[model samples]
Target: MTAEVDAYLSALPDDQRAALSDLRARLQILLPDHHEVMSYAMPGFRQPGPKGKMVVGYAAFARHLGLYPHSGTVIPLIDCAPFKTSKSGVLFTPDRPLPDALLSQIIATRQAELAAGYGKR
Candidate 1:
């Protein structure tokens, strides 16, 4: 992680910082095979397999942290509730948090989406 992203995440209130940190840490645990690095001016974790370079690949955004699966199927996972995604994202507000359950779902879905070659990756 870059000092910038670390600083950014660290600067938030303790709860918010912890929320993002927990999500980032969980991503590491869930995607051990993925390449974790700072990309696109954010902390990114890529699939790190034969097709790794296909995408940026996963990034943490300004308010919410997320991944870029490339296939775009991730849209549906957030379409329902707790998340509202546009054609490109899962909208995140500073008020609402990126939940652990949802994080797990996103990780699992990402694994599937990556396997399916969805979005940029």
Candidate 2:
């Protein structure tokens, strides 16, 4: 974990920090091994393939937690009606953490995008 990421999480209120921490743990477990770093001023993971790319990223905000798959292509690929979503990511609250199935789908879709050379820039 990067110091910036630690500081970011550490600065959050306990509930937010805990929620983000849980999300971080889930990402780490689901994605392949990678450098867990601070990217886009947020907690993110970068996989070491095809020139060490960023596979996914996430952050916590005042009202919700944000999960970024790092690709616009992934936004519409998954069904996220249960949560709020935008072109870049999904938003959910701490009290209502994202479901395991949805998380897997997001990560899977991101992985497919990477494998397909879709999100590389």
Off by over 4 Å in 2: none
- RMSD in Å for all candidates: 4.0, 1.5
User: Which clashing pairs does model 2 show?
Assistant: none
- Candidate 1 backbone collisions, by pair: 70-118, 70-119, 70-120, 71-118, 71-119, 72-119
Every candidate's lDDT: 0.59, 0.86
For model 2, the local distance difference test gives 0.86
**C-alpha lDDT (0 to 100) for residue 31 of candidate 1:** 72
Task: Give the Å shift of residue 40 in candidate 2.
Answer: 0.8
Candidate 2: deviation at residue 98, Å?
0.6
In model 1, the worst 10-residue window by lDDT is 53-62
| Model 2 C-alpha lDDT per residue in residues 1-121, reported as the tens digit of each score | 6788889999999998999999988888896578888888888998875577788899887788899988887978888988999998999988998999999999888888778887457
| Model 1 lDDT tens row, 1-121 | 5576687677677666676676567777777766766655555576676657433233445556454544456656553375666554455544675566776676677667656755552
TM-score of each: 0.63, 0.92
After TM-score superposition, the amount by which residue 24's alpha carbon in candidate 2 deviates from its true location, in angstroms, is 0.5
